[model samples]
Target: MPIANQNLFNQSRSFYLVSILELWQRFSYYGLQCILPLYFVWQLELTLADAFRLFSTYVALAFGFISVGRWLGEQILGIKRTLLLGSLLMMAGYVLLVLSTHKNGLIYFGLATISVGNGLFKTNPVALLSDIYNRTRFTLYHTLACLGSITAIILTPWVAHHYDWNIAFSLGVFGMFLVIIHLIFGKHYLNQYGTLTDQQPVSLKVGLLVSAIITAAIVFSSFLLHHQTAAPWILVVLFIANILFYWQKLINLKSAMRRKMMIVFILLLMVFVFFTLYLQIPTSLNFFAIHHVSHQVMGISFLPEQFQALNPIWIVITAPMLAALYNRLGNYLPIPHKLAIGMVLCSSSFLVLPWGATFSDSSGFISAHWLILSYALHSIGHPSISALGLIIVNRMVPAELKNFTTSMCFFTFAAAALTAGKVATQTIAPLYANSPYISLALYSEWFMKIGIVTAVIAVLMVISAPLIHRVMQSNQP
Candidate 1:
């Protein structure tokens, strides 16, 4: 009984410590992201297309490499050293970004460093957290991290708009160092956890060779795409590779696990589509808000970047209401059907954007009300797709493949980030570039096309929901 109590105390202590570190880390990351597109266009003097591609690549790479980082943490550096290295690398990246205000090469190098660092920092800490706490306590970590991201999005633009870019990047540097300080003091608690004995530690020679190859690859890719549009193609190739890999995995698994995995994959693809539309908040929609939406609400001036907060803000507000609503509905509304309903809601939000676009004035500045409604709809619709997707994936994935499946789930976000970037550049950016403010007709037309596609996807999801429910029911132990 005493031993169990000690274990619980250890877990509670480490979870709080880890949560703080994770929160600040996300704050640093999202702070950079909230203003990254604007920085590229306004400061770096890049075209909208170039800016979108670069931002997409950065976000995609940052997320996509998390699986690799997890493997490295477990196999090469172990949990403790990997976390330390990742924090230092992140700090270095921010320093380089701060320097990029004076020079361009620093920008890419800094981004690459941050990409690798974030990939490492993001996953390894979760592993450590899991070591201390059971699945039920996991939500606390995610919820806190979400709050950090939300806070960053809200505050970063305010800082950057009021101050300067260097100060903004410096905020990230400060946050990264805080993570280091917290870990340094708290390592004793975490050190007793998350050891993998089967995997051999990476040797110095192998590490050097791998580092050289990665550095060379980064340099080559940067040089190759320095003056071109390769981001979309890269994402497409990755999606295809993922599809093939999953297909092979499906063939190898037992029938019950295989069916469940296949359903999860389908659901993930739908999520990819949903985010391709949803994540535009940070890229295309952000630019749209800045250029075309009115800055004043009831005669009060506001920064354009502040609108990005609507997503997370609304999520926090509406998620409980949604959970309550779903609970009231009970088992009558199965998970798959609820997911389908969410997809439909998401599609409706896109459609709402185009409808609101028609109300823009001659100045092409739409009322803040329209953007507000669109965001509100998105807030409601997003949980249906994203939050539900996470829940369903958790329930569906077999125990043995949980980690790998979860890693694949992260990959979906990476793919969505890349897809969102492509959609923003190819579909949305062109309409806004030629005019001082994008016209109401242009806005309507642009979103109308996207709305139609998502609507079709939603309808398909509705059709399949029952079958998915049946499969899940049959497959359960």
Candidate 2:
């Protein structure tokens, strides 16, 4: 009984940490993504095309740096130093952003800080979570991270309303500071951070080359786009380097997956598709809330800016309940069923988005009460999906390759987040030019098309659910 209680206590502690840290991280990250476009367009008077490009670039950079951080941390730097360095960079970024008066230079400093800081924080957090939990408890613990993400969404609007965006961002810095406390005290729990003794670390020169390549690509891309100062074959070189990195990995692939490795590869690929869909909450839903919804209320409205908060809020509320349901049904249903449910819930939210769009063009600066209702539902759908994803990734992976494995999963998420913004940037531009906002009609058609496709995918997943279940059971040692 005491052993069970200790297990429960550790689980509880781990969950609380994951939820809270992610809550802070997302609160900062999403808030900027939510606010930056309007800030540029409204405050700086930049054109939508310019603002959208800058925002997409920044988001993509964040994703790119995450891969950098994960690779460096796992290879050369220990997770401890990597996390601490990340926090310092993030805090520095936020500080510069808050003080940034000029429109041009301010964004640069902020990006520099955020891009690096996130590389540090985002890569290690999941690895840390995996270190804390066993196979069965994986779902509940990861649900905490998902819940943290959800909670960030729920409170962002409220915080943005009550305080300036700068003030709200400082809260994230505070969260980073809070992580130092745990890092100091809970160092023992971070067993999953180091590389396995049997495996050799990648060479440092190759690592530096990879870093230099990423940095140069980002620089050339930004300069060429922003300044229209194209240098010769910059992208060609970067592309070749990236291709080479992967080609090298391909050569090493035979040795990479000596253990239960196919699951990581498969899950990474599958999740890239899955997250590409879910990560749209920040990008596509932005226009959906601003234009399609019917009403607005309080400081919170169903504006595109406000919609990002919903997924986070709903996750906080629903995660515990969903975790409970999964635990109860664990005996009866397999993990794949839970994943199927999550997929259905995600696609269903899009179906509902179109319905809400039909009621009003909240795009024309009308109220957002009805739109918020739609957002509330969207938020609720995410936790189950996220929790189950944790179960799938963590359970299928062996302990020795935790960070490397989790890095692949992180790449999926990073790729998805970047893709969401990129797709939104491209798709929303034409709509904005034609309609001035995401018109109710346009919004409806968009969601309907997406919903139909997602629904079909969900159906296929449902059919395959049993196969995954059998796989999990068969693989269980």
Candidate 3:
């Protein structure tokens, strides 16, 4: 091969390795996610409020600890080793999940372990890819993640139904095992990359400090999972602390960089809002599907978890087209405008649910088509905001701070997950005590209120797009 061609091939090879790892990692993660609430409700016999609280806390901590993971990768282990360590930890977590089928207390520990491992594993690969490639690959990578999610959403539930939850959880164990095996075999391709910390010698003090921090984080995560009521206060404190930390950091940057960082913070807030709405999928929406939506479509029975597949399935269909359109439009469209469009779609998704409720049959069960439509809109809206938000933050931050900034993006997600949990616990869970028909009406009303609020936000975002766009285009630091 020509020199340029060989380099391109090698880069592509490395990208594929990272992307595939993401694919399987998401497979494992989403597989567990799809079943977790159900597991808490049915297997562990928790109330809806408690279930959502645990689920949200687990999710919040998973993303929350990404900052710690990035620190480890940057300051101690280097990205490659950190990634390996995380995968191994995730495998252990999954193993504990399988064991939890017999010993219920093990589930909290299992979830805590997975959360920490996810924190470590999530951002490093993207950081590694950003180091090697200049072009934005967020859409492509997210599509791969969606693919993994779709497969997991479909299969995990089926496995749990046909076989057992232990076997289903074991699928995650197998997925992580594959991730570890692939990482080991593929390390050579990535050796030239993610080595920023490899040359630095770790002192015993630093190593011990890092270990202590990780242990404390795990313990805190497990505590939150077990003690659901404490989550709200803890999340609020974390959220405020994150904002203050970023605010202080933002003011210290050069003028142009400061402006860009300001926009990044704005976008992150938007992400928090977006995910707070989107996360209803695995919690309230899943419950809605099980209780209110018709399970039979064309004489075929579908599991509630299987319906979660619709979002990813829609993404798989729409992502390439959206990517192509974005490429074709080039700089004509700004990121803020795209995000505004997403917010509009998200609002519309919920708005349609209330309208769809009117068409319910005598049994108070709505057609699955309503959910299909809702998910379609939700999926299309995701890449516009979440994927672009990541790309924007990655582009705006200083090189040294890239991993940390990326982790901060995940931190917004963490806050959003916590908020979503609160929403579920406070809003949706209470409706569960009502009859299904009354709950359906109340759910629609709540959905309408959310839709209206998001619609208002979308309008504001649209109005602000030009200003944000101009700021983004101003002089670089």
Candidate 4:
């Protein structure tokens, strides 16, 4: 058996290189996201629903196509080339976004490029790191990603407000350029992780042919699905396909494996609900904060995007404590039970928003503390569900199928993004259109409804914990 390597904690040079590169990539991505919603609504003149739909689609496809990127890296471009391509494509996407300030048709095309580029770039570095260290440093990667997001949320909006939107986006483009330069210089560290001689390789001709066909198909689909109304149906079709594919995979497992797979499936459902609720942070929740929350907190005026920093800042501050708690509680509680607690906390986060909304004064400015508290609640739940979900996937899935299973797990998030978009369209879009400047009462009602529905999901997760525990016991490693 190959011995497991554990050098990640040692802070090796290669590790720092990859981590820094990954951090910059995340910085560029989230920096844009910090301003993307307002850009769509304010600059593009899109309705709330349309903006959210496009955002949802962008997020869904960015993550959903990671599997495709992995395949292309392994089979055709190799990891180094794929990474290079991703950086270029993402930079191009940012440039197009800036140009979209003038020409609108470039918006979707830009989003599509960024989505594909992110998928290709994000995970491959981790894969290389895994090969180098002989272990996965998922948490470290996640922490850095969150830190990047925090920095972006704190700075990007301030830049856009003080300077210009194009300048803010140009900053993102510059970051990507730095990433490309770093990767090109430091790429030798990743050479050993590239396609191996033992692995079956695709012919270049065949790979190019396949890529062309896929591109053609995507173009045709975009043409057909040009209407905003058609976006949800596309998501529905994709969701159904993912479900059917997962079911087919489950059929071939032995009885024990099947039970474990079922538990994984159940856990994935809980996570889907969690993400559906959590994503409001970037979409509807941010809008609410900008419109309703007091700009002056303790007599200091802050940008709306800075509000997003709360959740990540909380996560960073509390992560070590949470890690220690997890270690102390190791196997004392079932994973399902721990996840149930997370779901409950997530539900409570939403539930708290309504109460916060109640604090709005006659001028419609509510204390930012309520939103801060909501973010804190969400930060607690975020790791509980997300981190544990990944750990559970690694532990429960069969060795040979781990990568495939993990891809499918990410697919759940894509579905959740789409679902969240649909929810926003139904709940938030109408309110924004009717009120233009939303009232405290409408905000409270909207928060209450989502909170109630999410609470029901939390309840379901709690009730199912025992059953999942029972199945999990039979498949314990």
- Model 3, 247-349: lDDT tens digits are 8887788988888888888888899899999889999889889878998778898997899999889999998998899889888988878989999999999
Error of 1 at 429 (Å): 6.3
Q: Which ten residues in a row are the worst by lDDT in model 1?
A: 1-10
Q: Report each candidate's C-alpha RMSD, comma-separated, in the order given.
A: 3.5, 6.1, 2.9, 3.3
Ranking of predictions according to TM-score: 3, 4, 1, 2
Candidate 4's residue-wise lDDT over 1-477, tens digit each?
Answer: 223333556655666667777878888898887678788888878888888887887777777777877876776667767777788878988888777774567767776777778877877887667765654455666677678778877888888899888888887788788889888897665545556621445578866875684475345334422554665577678678877888898898887888898888877887888888877888888888888888777889898778988888888877767777877887787788888888888778877877876666877777988888888888888888988887788888888778777777778888898888877665464434545335556667778888888788778878888887787677344
User: Cα lDDT of model 1 overall?
Assistant: 0.77
Instruction: Give the Å error, residue 340, model 1.
Output: 1.5
By lDDT rank, best first, the candidates go 3, 1, 4, 2
Where in model 2 is the C-alpha error above 4 Å?
Answer: 1-23, 129-267, 294-304, 361-381, 394-405, 426-438, 472-477
Point out the higher-scoring one by TM-score: 1 or 4: 4
List the pairs of residues colliding in candidate 3.
none
Q: Which candidate is the best by lDDT?
A: 3
Q: Put down candidate 1 lDDT per residue, 1-477, tens digits, no spaces.
A: 011223343546667878888988988998898899899889889888878888887877787768767776777667767777788878888999888874667788788788878877887877777677665565456667768878888788888888998888898998898999998997766655765722356788977965774466446444423533665567568667877877887788878878888899898888888877876888878888887889888898889888887777777677777777888898899988988887777777768877766777777778887787788877788867876888788888878777777778778888788778778875453443666444445556767888788889889889999998888888544
Superposed model 1: Cα runs more than 4 Å off: 1-11, 197-228, 231-235, 254-256, 324-330, 398-404, 427-438
lDDT of each: 0.77, 0.58, 0.84, 0.76
lDDT of 2 by residue, 1-477 (tens): 011113355655544555456555665676566667666666678765566556655654566567667765666565555666676667767777777764566657566667767876675766655555554655455555555455554555556667676665666566566666666575554433444521344467865874575466445444643542122233235434644553454454444332235544544555655666665655566655555444346654343565566655566567667777867887687776766676676677778766654454334443465455555555555655555676676776556555555555554565565455455554454534566344555556766777787678778778977766666655334
Error of 2 at 295 (Å): 4.6
